[model samples]
Target: MPVLEVRRHTMRSKPGQHLSQQGVTLASLIGNSTGPFDLVWTSEKPRAIETAIAMGYTLTRQSAALGNLPKSILDAVAWPNDLESISKIVRRNNACERFARAQAEEWRSIAGELKDNQSALIVTHGAIIELGAIGFMPNATYSTWGDAIGYCEGFRFSQVEGLETCELLRVPSHLQLIHN
Candidate 1:
């Protein structure tokens, strides 16, 4: 089944933010869903929670398994070159690596709980989404600390034995739009 990894829509609080468009798009997508959703999940943050509510899903328990991220240990994250550095960093921190490992394990367990073809929506922070997805992929490995994460970007994967490596399905819909 396809997981609609929606980046939560805009917050009225942050007037004129890029995320507003993402929020609008998410609203459009959810409004268009004709089938029943098995579950809806969201981050503790108000923006994410409000987006989930607007999308019309009743709340499931919030997940620390999907919470705001701790920064990675690697130096400045630049990708390509930084990817190797990040992987090296993950190889260094026993605790951070452990967290990543645990997260993947939990997602595997969570996938089993869902009914076959059951549609579930998880409204969460971008870091958690990246940690849950890229941190769990195959052929790719990383340091437990210092993973470069961007906002509102995430992935989708089919559950086989465990949560498979995911493709980045969405990104923060707006950032430049956010103003103090």
Candidate 2:
């Protein structure tokens, strides 16, 4: 099976467009332990691109779809929602479902293109990751997923027999601590 690991960009100051110095360090640490991915993708946002580079991966692609959700969608769903809430919204909202489906298709297409034993990495934003995961695995138990993803947190998705599976990916607790 081919795997796709999708993560939000590393830390950035609120209202800032670029990665913070600590974000660079955190991404470097993450790179050391994870992936020699076959392909890497990012959002068009500088923070996303910088996270991939800091993780030492060559950029394979960038898409704005991974960066920003539409204003209408943003207005419809509250920010920082857990998977369960997002799932409910997806089921009830046509626009949300459409966006989620598109995200899932992009992930599937990327994963499908890879050979067996190969994997891809996508560094994107929070809501995009959550919606894509829910869209890809609608039957998954969302209540177990806890809160929404934070910086550098996301999911690992893989396909088997035309069905998709998702696993939450979290940065190590040690790496999450702020240094004085």
Candidate 3:
């Protein structure tokens, strides 16, 4: 079985939407700590591509399934309308949940297709990797995403065929403490 590691792209420059110092830090950390991967994938986004390259992946491929939730969906979440009727709210919420579940299933299918002894690395966004993939993670390892997945944070899964549960290898840690 191969292990699949999913990472969130680190901080990006806002104005130009490029990699930031925090992003560089994450790339350097991964390059120093992790072993060489058999396959590397990044979401079809510049920030994700930059993160993968900085992590020493010279031949990273783009996987749309590993990208962020759709912009319109994200916008809805970020700025939800409080004026919506009950039925409208229910429909919107259900739609978003369905989309997240689909994303998780897609990643699971991708993981199942990996050959033995092949480790796959993915660089993606927080919403997709954090919230979307939470339910797929081992219950013992991660009960919930719970805001632990900050910028560039991620988790690793031991991907075995027919396994509904996976072994969690790493839990993202804060590179710097947020509180005094």
Candidate 4:
């Protein structure tokens, strides 16, 4: 997720927020990559839907299953801010492990189904990129969970024998921070 557009939401949770300037920059940046996606999946959230549209994809399905990780457990427990701790394990489980498993399964099925040169794009949350990509590649690591992929950046994957491989991909510069 981009800095301004980054956050998590569950089904029926609405932020009532519109696109930020950073988000529009991302859309134009990501859109430049000609995506002839055969199918585009997105969360029902406006950010995800809009991100997909901004990137020039037509949404084929919007699913809650592909949305952000449920934050109920994290909300229930009062935890320290330190990420490198025993408490992080519990947070990681709730926010990452299980959701990653589910997403990896879905990714595997899609990877298996696609033909040569065919592609599917999933516009989803940061957790879906971090935990999910790491789930598929157990050795992957990052300075923090959220840092696994930046806002508007993600992993491209290919699966074989029920395992998927990931390659990090980022949105190109839209020149908002650059002087002309």
lDDT for each residue of candidate 1 in 19-132, tens digit (9 for 90 to 100): 465565554454455335576666666666666666666777566555555565222222323334544445566655565566556565555567667756666654344444
Sort order, lDDT high to low:
2, 3, 4, 1
**Which of candidates 2 and 3 reaches a greater lDDT?**
2
Q: Give TM per candidate.
A: 0.59, 0.92, 0.73, 0.67
Residue 26 in candidate 1 has what lDDT?
51
Give the 10-residue window scoring lowest on summed lDDT in candidate 4. 1-10
lDDT of 2 by residue, 1-180 (tens): 788899888987669888889888888888888899999989899999999999899999998778878988866657689889988999999999998899888887778779988999999887888888888887899999978888888888877798777888888888768411
Q: RMSD per prediction, one decimal? A: 6.2, 1.9, 5.7, 6.9
Any residue pairs clashing in model 3, and if so which? none
Candidate 4 Cα misplacement greater than 4 A, ranges: 1-15, 72-95, 139-146, 159-164, 172-180
lDDT of 1 at 117: 78
* Model 3 spans with C-alpha error above 4 angstroms: 75-92, 138-145, 159-174, 177-180
* Best-fitting candidate, scored by TM-score: 2
Residues 1-180 of candidate 4 have per-residue lDDT tens digits of 101111222112235545565675556566566466787777777877877777776887787766756675334222222223313453455554565567667655555556665777777765454544545555544334333355566767665555544556654455435101
- Candidate 4's displacement at residue 122, Å, is 0.5
